[model samples]
Target chain A: METREMTCINCPLGCLLTVTKDNGKVTVTGNTCPRGEDYGIKEMTDPRRTVTSTVRVKNGSAVKVPVKTKTDIPKDKIFEVMDVIRKAEVKPPVHIGDIIVDDIAGTGVPLVATKDVE
Target chain B: MYCRETDVVIIGGGPAGLAAALAVKAAGVESVLILERDTQLGGILNQCIHNGFGLHTFKEELTGPEYAARFIKRVLDEKIEYMLETMVVDLKSDRTVVAMNRKEGLFSIKAGAVVLAMGCRERPRGALGIPGFRPAGIFTAGTAQRFVNVEGIMPGSEVVILGSGDIGLIMARRMTLEGAHVKLVAELMPYSGGLKRNIAQCLNDYNIPLKLSHTVVDIKGKERVEGVTIAEVDERLKPIPGTEEFYPCDTLLLSCGLIPENELSGSAGVALSPVTGGAVVDNTLETSIPGVFACGNVLHVHDLVDYVSEEAENAGRGAAEYVKGQKAGIVPEDDTVMEMKAGKGVRYTVPAKIRPATVKKDVLVRFRVDNNYKDVSIGVFYDGRLERSVKKRTVAPGEMEELRIRKEELDKYPEVKEITIGFVE
Candidate 1:
């Protein structure tokens, strides 16, 4: 059995949450919302975070267009995903939601443009 | 000089200006113009490429540009007119705007109402009074953000951030992702001025240490920043002797604070609030000058852009009403005006005055705290009588808190002379 205390990142309230893992069963307490419980469980299991960064743009008004993962990626892969983002480049007239990279860093999460570059 | 007439003239093209223009057009104002000094719309959001914006307004986490595009699309679809690369040189108390552009040498607009949404600027190194030599690697956090995010240029390979402001926190993560080593982030205050999420996601996740109650005492470099000397400060913020620590870094980023860009407001003879560094406004966001309205960071620095949009809408609607009132020749009769005083632990409140007669439904009073408190209750008092009290588990100076007072509630306190907001232990 293991227990961990952490702050909920779901919202600004930042409710303090305690997660206890006993006999492979996880129980979360001190959460004001269900999302907080889910967050606590995820933290104890597999942590994920949405990555936001800029990629170089070619012949666009902006030198770099901002991009983000379609969904949250594993926490341990943040730097690796950033490495892939740092090396990736896109051309002008990129619209929001345009896919920048597919299956980035083997995370099965595609990188999508968050801003239009024209 | 070319002359034009407009029902409403917004003095900026940032989020505040864009939202205000959209609101004015929606309110049936035919002639509305936005003046932007930048070559593009969206202001600083263009450089803030990070996510976590529009969580409240859009109900989804969005990057700055994505959030801005939503509003920019509305402005375009509404056929609102805006001039890029144009700057409003002067704003007069009589609602006259003198503006300049490359194509139009000099132009003047006679406006029925003017909305001052000029926003705010970062406090620079000169304002901090840190003993330092003018160096190339030292930059304001926003300026560094612009350089790195927009221009694709790295400011330095090694960095030391001087404040834990949101911008500084974001930049700490950004610089690290860009392959720069951020040694540490030193904040002068004991409590961080940034949102808690930022501290967790940006610094704690990245393993960067945050030194609270610490400040940079000296900058060591002649041309480019070579390093900085940091020291701990007492409760009074005076640096204690013999606590100096040195970190070797090429760049020093200052995210100390933001100041309301009110030079135009000052020249326009608007009444300014010493505490907020913005304008003294009434419930309708009307400045001392009748039809001139102020919102967004120009009124008070907001922690979220969503609040800025909301506040700008109020200013826009107020301007529209002012224009209508002028055309109808119905000058508002002076009604019951109550001053809002900040009591203990409260810093200052927006809409310094509340005119019950002018408010249609409710008035939202936004304020901040001087220090951090845990498990405290916020008391809203009317003439020494408690009107409402809200219990908060934790409140920090970084986040702006708001309280809504309905017009109906004010009616119950008809003889209310003053409204005071304070902290109850």
Candidate 2:
């Protein structure tokens, strides 16, 4: 069993949290709000974060309007996910929140809009 | 005058207003109206093409437009009435908003409670005290974003962002991808004012240089921005003499900071907090005025849109409760009051004053520090007398920290008249 001290990043409070793991089970404590609890579990069991960056665009003066995965992806697959996003090209007249990738790398994190581009 | 009478009237049809209206409906008060100045319901979010919102409440990453669409759809589904192209020119003391728009020359609405969510405005070059002749190339970050995202216009080929705030950082990456040569992102502060992720993804990933402890001392141009003089600053914030350098750029994008849109609130005769330059409110988010509530960017600059939604909902719920006669206003029972000051290394704390009745156990006292301090203890004092201390491994002035004193712990401090929060090494 191993123990870790972390801060919950879900809210502005930045609550000091403790997470303990034995075998494969995880336990989290010391969060003030519900969002903190969710963040703690995600941090302990399966940490995932939505990746946002730019992608190659077609037929536009500006290259990017910022794009991000719609869902959280596994911690390790971020670079692989970006490679795919960088290679893919979206035609102009894209509205904000238009889904680019439904399930990127099968991580279930859909690539979505960050800014509108036309 | 076409007067729309309602219990609560909200201004600015953004996510804040949408959330506020939804919260009002959830609280069992339905006579709510949201007035928008734009042709559509969504405000700035329509142009904010980036993702980074709706992570907490929705548990999914959504673009600005997508996030606003969710609430706007919900507001429509709930039958929340709103007016488009409605610009409120005058708000009266009796809670009436007088507006003039294209379709209608004049209209009025009498509201029992008002939620001001006008959001904020970006700081421009003039606000930064940069010595320069007025030129055509200088633009605020928001204007640049709108030009690029909405109108599909490239503001410039060479860009130098004046502030390392989120907007500036985001623009740096944007201009680069747009085939523009972005020279640098200059910031007056040593540390970035934007989120850590923004600094990483926007600048670092793009190899865009970030110049810290720097300032644009002078701007030189005739018809358009030709070049700018940059200088390094000392601890006192005065530009050092020999550290002056010049960078040639056709465009200067200022993302210095954001100011709360509090003109209407000021006109309403509401008390303002000098620290945040926003309306002061109790726990209920109600302004000093009997039935006026303020939230979102109009109240204070928020780091995340999620917090803005949460606060706007609080204001909406509070307004609903007030209109329903569910909440009774009263002078705090404990006549004793303590003036809370952000002692050394602290920027400011909200409310500024605390009453025993309004002080709750687990009170979330949010305050910012003046500098980054490692191994610091936040000390709470009662009128110069030490009460309690919470130790922190690391704390920064850029980030707001909240310290909680349980109701049980608060009960012990009976003689407390005023509380002061400060940091020490």
Candidate 3:
């Protein structure tokens, strides 16, 4: 039996959640929303987070352009994803939602520009 | 001096100015001008490269720049006239705006209506007044953000942040992602000033400790930051005698608070609210100076930029109405004004006054609470009597609260002079 206390990041109203796992069965308490229970379950299994970072820009108006993963990636893969992003560079006319890196760090998630760098 | 005329002149070319310009054009006002001091149009949003913006306005999560780009695109598509790198130095209550740019040395604009959307500035280290040696590595979170996200320069390798504001929290994660070790986050108040989700994603995700009720009492270093000494505070917010702990770091980030940029509004003789540090506005967002309107962070600090856009749109529509009303010779009566007051458990409310007749459909009253509350009911009182109350699961000072009063609601109580919003047991 294992128990862990955490705050649900699903919404602004962060509900303090108590997740109890006993023999593969997980029970979440103190959650106001069902998403909190899902979060608790996901935390017990595989934690995921949407990573946002700045990629260097070449010949763009700004020196760097902000980019984010298309979807949430495994939490443990953040450093690897950042490593790929740090080395990546792009040119001007980069629009928002433009793919900067495909299959970033083997996460199968493409990194998209969050800002226009023109 | 070069001179021009416009129906409305909006100060600042950020999200507020962009949205206001679009709204003004939508209201059939042709001559609208936006003055931006920055070389670009997006203002601070260009530097804020994080996602989680525009959930309300765009109905989807967007980064700060992306959110601003949407409105910027709209303003451009609408063919709104705007001047970049043009600073509005002086604004008169008579709608005379003195501005300057590289191309135009000095110029004046006769505006029928003006919108104040100067935004806000981060509180500096000098404002906090911690006893410390002058150091080089100390930077406000926003400045550091501009350095890293915009200029592609790392401020430091190690950081100790003071204040649990959203900027500080975001920077903690940002610095960490860039290989900097964020030691800890110390906040003065027992409760965090940032959103709860930030605490979870920014701090908790990185295993950064958030020490609430703790503050930096001393900063140690000569030319560069060496360390910071944090101490736990008592109920009165005074540091305890022996609760000092030293943290060795290369940088100390300050995310204390934000102050509304209202110097131009003040110079224009707009009535300023002591609590909000912004202009005292009516329901139409018109300042006491009549034709001048205020919105966005220049009106009050907002956690969400979507609200800033929404509020600025209201100000824009109001400015458009003012310009059209003047041409039609339609004047509003002063007797229809209703005063708004903040009762117990509420800190302050925006739109300090409301003219029931001027409110088109609904009057949106936004406010902040004095402290944290659980399972509380927010009561809207009319002349000291509870007229409407809504139950809230939780309310905190960090999150802004809003209550909408329909035009018919005010018509029911015609004799009511004052409306107060507060927490009820």
Candidate 4:
């Protein structure tokens, strides 16, 4: 059996969660809500994060436009996603929610613009 | 000097100002004008490009810019008047505003009501008093954020962050994602000043070490930063000898704390709270000057922009009520004005004083804990009796806590003169 402790990030409350793994069974303790249990189970298995960064803009009001993954991606794919976004640029009249990169870092998450540039 | 007249004049274009303007207009006030110092409407939210905004306002997670855009679109749709690059140089208690801009050389506005939403400024290195040479590599966390997120410029290739506030924690991850090696984040306090979610997602997930009870003791460099020497601090927050360690970095970011920008408020003869550093407002969000209102960061630093919008709405509604010369409720002179006091284990509370007549439904008193506490209850005491108490598993100085006092409850204590909020273990 293995045990790990982590702070649940699902909400601002930030309940401390203790996850214990034995063979194929997982038990989470010290959580105030069920979301903490789900977060613990996922942390023990597959951890994910939503990546937010800026992309270069051309012929726009600003020099850069901030972008973020529409959903949480695999934790390890953050740098890879950054690499793709670093080399990417968008044109003027770009609206918020515009797709900047499709399926970023092969995480099946689309990078969308978070600001409107005209 | 050019002169104009308006029913209401808001002194900012940020989330607070925008929400206030919308509420003022919705309250049947016409000719509302917003004066913005920046070239755009979003204010700081434009540079805060990170997500995690609007969860309470929009019911969906959004980036700072996205959240601002939602409000901006509403302002435009509502046809509210606003001037970009306009700076309010002087504000008087009589609702006279003196402003200037390139387009409008000098002008003044006689407003029926004024809403101060100038927001807050981050505490800089000058305030920290760290023994360091004046170096170009040092930047406030918000300035660095603007550089990376807006200007597309990297502050440095290697970074060391001082103060584990949310901005510092966010920038640590940002600099790392942009290929900078963030050596570590050293915080002076025993506990982090940032939200727990930020510490977990921005620092823990990035594998960045957060050294609490540590602070920068020395800075090495002449023209630019070469390195920083950090040392562990004792219980008194004094540096302990022989615990010094040096880390080489080209950049250092400070995210200590935010101070409410109230110079304009002071100039307007608005009484300020030493603890909040903002205006001393009543339950209606009106300052000592009857027609003047304040909200958002300019009134008190808030953890969430959603709360800022809500508070600004209250200010806007109050200002509109003042302009219309009618209030929702009448105050009886016999009822004593109640003072909100911060008791043990708690910091200051907003709405420093409340007049029983101003509360139509309920009044929300928000405050922060003085220290990190576990398994505690927040007790609200009126006069000498415990009126209400709430149990919390944990509370920290970094997060703001709130409690609602219904009007019916206050009606029961008409002669109550003081309300104390304290922690009950």
Using TM-score as the measure, the top candidate is: 1
lDDT of 2 by residue, A1-118 (tens): 9888776655444567788888988777877777767777777788776666665567764465557776678866876786677577788777656888788887876887655557
Candidate ranking (TM-score, best to worst): 1, 4, 3, 2
Give the true-structure RMSD of model 3. Answer: 1.7
Looking at model 2, the pairs that clash are A70-A110, A114-B49, A114-B50, A114-B51, A115-B49, A115-B50, A116-B49, B338-B417, B338-B418
- Summarize candidate 1's per-residue lDDT along B1-425 as a digit string, tens digits: 89999999999989999998988888878789999999888988888888888978988988898989999999999989999999888988888999999999899999999999999999999999999889889999999999988889999999999999999999999999889999999999999988887888889888999999999999999989999999999999999999999999999999999999999899989999999999999998999998999999988998889999999999999899889888899966867889998877999998889998887889999999899888889998888778789998788899898998788878888788899998864
- The residue ranges of model 4 lying beyond 4 angstroms of the native Cα positions read A23-25, B326-336
Clashing residue pair totals per candidate (backbone < 3 A):
0, 9, 0, 0
The order by descending lDDT is: 3, 4, 1, 2
Worst ten-residue run, lDDT, model 1 chain B? B331-340
Candidate 3 on A1-118: residue-level lDDT in tens? Answer: 9999988886666788999999999999989988899999998878898899999888878898899999999999999999999999898889889999999999999999988778
- lDDT of candidate 1 at residue B114, scale 0 to 100: 96
- Alpha-carbon runs more than 4 Å astray in model 3: A1-5, A17-41
Decoy 1 TM-score against native: 0.98
Q: Ten consecutive residues with minimal summed lDDT in candidate 3 chain A? A: A7-16
Ranking by DockQ: 4, 3, 1, 2
Structure candidate 3, residue pairs in collision: none
User: DockQ for all models, in order?
Assistant: 0.67, 0.14, 0.74, 0.82
Single-chain TM-score of chain A, each candidate: 0.98, 0.87, 0.95, 0.95
DockQ of 2: 0.14
Residue B32 of model 4, lDDT score: 96
Please give, for residues B1-425, the per-residue lDDT of candidate 3 as tens digits: 99999999999999888888899999999999999999888888898788788878877878888888888888889999999989999999898999999999999999999999999999999899899899899999999999999899999998999999899999999999999999999999999999998998999889999999999999999999999999999999999989999999999999999999999998989999999899999999999998999999999999989899999999999999999999999876745889999998999999999898887788999999999888899999998899889998889999999999778878998888999998875
